[model samples]
Target: MTPPAITGQVALVEDDYTLVINRGTEAGVVAGMVFAVSSGTGQVITDPESGRELGRLSREKLRVRVFDVQPLFARAHTFAETDSFYGLLRIPFVATDDVVTIDVGDPVEAIAIEGMGYRKEANGY
Candidate 1:
């Protein structure tokens, strides 16, 4: 049987920085999943203590998933440089499944799962 359909939004994005994924049992991120990386151009103006947003400067869909997450922790490059980076985790085979992108301040979920093929290729086995 196929895996259940899953959907999520981009929860986090580290622009111009490398996202270090732990392939160990800690992080639950699996292979064959797609993530969306986005950015906001507008200024997020807000009160000092109240934390109330005064207004939005601008918003834009910077870039889509350019990197298909490999099974191991390697240096994955970014498509473009921006202020924010969001990771939307979703199973690709599941068409109906909703995808949730990760944004700033979101909890990190899932460890990177190293596929056998990827390991062999990387090690030249």
Candidate 2:
């Protein structure tokens, strides 16, 4: 099945562990969506006259999924420290040459999800 497209800011990042995003269902987030983690590095896309390149936010494209979601109050303590949701994702695939890295307060984008064999549109969920 095609994955849904969602956008949110990165809340936290820890290699081989977990990556979290701020916006969730309250922000119209859903499960089974794929997210790409990026770093704040690269040519800045800006207007020549202004000489501003946005927020100079670079990121790494790390594919992740929305495994859990909780209300803001339910996650007040955690969200207070960081204004984002707790996203749990497992890294099952990685490139040998690609270095995996992420930082707190980055940006996340829900790309696409790979369809499962047992699930289909008509009779599957």
Candidate 3:
């Protein structure tokens, strides 16, 4: 049988910084795990020839690491990729003309369980 799907949504945002996801220990979530939040306005991709809906392509808003977890939820935050030399904060990578922040109810997906590959290709394999 197939395992249950592990998916969640952004439940809250604290002061426009901290984000809360709806999955937690009950869903196999642990601290230091990364979750990706995608924008809701995803463009639907379709097959040109058959005119069949293939999938939705959405821009990932940002990735957050969970620092706090409870039975039913988790809190997370993200830090900008800083300049090592001068410690300057860089602009958001996915910056759009209008929005660059995580909004409540955005879809969140776990970034765990990278699949099989040539072992030599991975570092320290």
* TM-score order of candidates, top first: 3, 2, 1
Per-residue CA lDDT of model 3 for 3-96, tens digit only, reads 3445799999975557899999999877866677888778999999999999988788876767799999999876443443221442323333
Q: Go through the candidates in order and give each one's C-alpha lDDT.
A: 0.33, 0.50, 0.70
* Top candidate by TM-score: 3
Write down the worst ten-residue block by lDDT for model 1. 114-123
Clashes of 2: 14
Alpha carbon deviation, residue 54, candidate 3 (Å): 1.2
Looking at model 1, residue 35 earns an lDDT score of: 27
Q: Tens digit of lDDT per residue, candidate 2, span 1-125?
A: 54344566677553454667787676655565556666656556777899776655354455566556654300101110012222223334444575566667556665543343222222123
lDDT of 1 by residue, 16-123 (tens): 333333231123335432223333345789989899998765333222322334444322222322232322332212213544333443222221122222121111
How many clashes does each candidate structure show, in the order listed?
Answer: 29, 14, 0
